[model samples]
Target: MTTAFDPVRIGALELANRIAMAPMTRSRAHGPGATATELMATYYEQRAGAGLIITEGAQPSVVGQGYPDTPGLHTAEQVEAWRATTDRVHAAGGAIFAQLLHTGRIGDAALLPGELIPVAPSAIPAAGQVYTHEGPKPYPTPRALTEAEIAETVDDFARAARNAVEAGFDGVELHGANGYLIQQFLSSNANRRTDGWGGTVEGRIRFAAEVTAAVAGAVGGDKVGLRISPGNTLHDIAEDDVEQTYKALVADIAGLDLAYLHIMESAGMRDLTASLRARFTGPLILNPNTLPEPTGPDALSLIEDGTADLVSYGALFLANPDLPARLAAGGPFNAPDRGTMFGGDQHGYTDYPTLT
Candidate 1:
């Protein structure tokens, strides 16, 4: 039986272990052009013990950014800035993937530059507030993307994937989970369109499929990965037919021969998880739904049972830089500092002690 510490092959790369450090938003991209900072490089280097390190979501386009201080890959300077982080991780014998995310309608206008507003499949406004640099503000009604803009957005993802490779990342993961742009299009409530992009299940999954294909084409299918949440309702997203929608979407892209399919499981979706896992023949990385409590070391057994090829940990890896080492020993893990989890200094970001 394989364990979390076992080696696994993901696409053209071979990871040293099945322990992956999940992408997390630390909101500390304090570089020019929303680029990554040297501190961010240090943070990633500290956690290089993991088999893979998926960086925080970086917007593919300028308008794709929904939060302050989040990094982006839309500019040359941004591409150059990320090199430091990727180089540090590689030098430490770790593989890294840049997660490209676009917040369709979950952002506040205050976070955007100039008079630009958010864009989604439709002009509908999601219920809830988004945290801005100024304060928490209500989500604004996003402008519906014209068919031409939709095509352009797809191109943007492809371009970003190329940029990620140029920046020295092992691969790129499209953020189709956590109520982002891709999930916005997949949501019945969020995406109420009547064009080729929405309405029918086929239409709704079109944008996601196109984006994936484009990115895969830009940076070989073997260098691409996608993250999705089948039944997640975060940011007021409602999916009446969760299983049917995701099943179709996975089937649509399964032929791409992607590097992996990452599922951020929601509550009571174990059956859906198994179904999707069986549908996609590629490696599967699971961030299981152990809500009310962050994913713990116990999830490693999922690998031994063949439930997932690799298990991802968020909060656990955040607090413990050498999380795999601690898990191997089976004790003495550091608790994540809730208050300092986001938008802070080295105290909570890279100051976590390792069992040296």
Candidate 2:
């Protein structure tokens, strides 16, 4: 019987196992010019037991950044800095993919260069606060991107994808999930534009599909993946009629034949996953967002049952460096310290001891 420990092929890259390390922001990019530091390399290399390591969200442009200490890929310096981390992961026999993220309206001007206000699909303020260098502040109403700016944003994603390849990453994953820029366009409450970019399901999905196509064109189609969280209301996004919107989205991008579609499991979305699995004709990575319960046997069962080709773990992979071996043994898992999950030194980042 096929198991999560079995090998799987994601696009042109061959994964040693079916377990993927989901991207989690560590806010430890303490290098000059928002570059990835050697500490980040050591951190990823320690967790290289994952079949595929999806690095933390990387801002594609200066204004796209949402948080402090997060890395970027727009400049030559950023790309060069990421190379060492990718090289370390590869040396450890792991395939790494840089997750290109554009935070959109989920940002604060205080966190951006020159205090640049965030741009979103619409000029509405999210119903929550965003963290900045000063502290947490209420989300400011973002400026809507003009048609020309939207085009430039698409080009930004494509350029970031190319930069990931130049940084020695095996591939790139577009961060279309959460309530970020892509999801900002997908949500009805967030995207109220009247142009071709909004007002309908087809229009709303246009930005995501166009971004995917452009990235795939810049890199290889098989070297690109997308992550989506339908019905996710994070960052104050209101995704009314999630079923209709996501079905249209999946249908629109199915023809792209990209590497994989990563779907985060949400409450009341099981049937939607089933429908999406049938609709998308490529590999699927399921992120079972069930916390407290360890993603050990249950996640493998998803792969065994054909609901997902692979499974991704976030906190488990963060605390357990040799997660594959630990899962195989099914004993003695380390608990992650919530305090150090975000910004921190090597204490919780690279000091996790592997089974000896």
Q: In angstroms, how far off is 100's CA in candidate 2?
A: 0.5
Query: Candidate 2: worst 10 consecutive residues by lDDT?
Result: 290-299
Tens-digit lDDT track for model 2 on 183-282?
Answer: 9999999999999999988999999999999999999889899999988889988887789988888898888788899998888788999899899988
Residues 1-356 of candidate 1 have per-residue lDDT tens digits of: 89998899999999999989999998999887799999999999999999999999999998999888899999999999999999999999999999999998988777678989999999999899997778788899999999999999999999999999999999999999988899999989999999999998998999999999999999999999999998898998988688889999999998899999999998789888999999997999999866444455568878988889999989989999999998899858899998887786788999989999
Best by lDDT: 1
lDDT of 1 at 75: 97
Model 2: residue 141 alpha-carbon error in angstroms: 1.3
TM-score of each: 0.98, 0.98
The pairs that clash in candidate 1 are none
**Model 2: residue 219 alpha-carbon error in angstroms:** 0.3
Question: Worst ten-residue run, lDDT, model 1?
Answer: 289-298
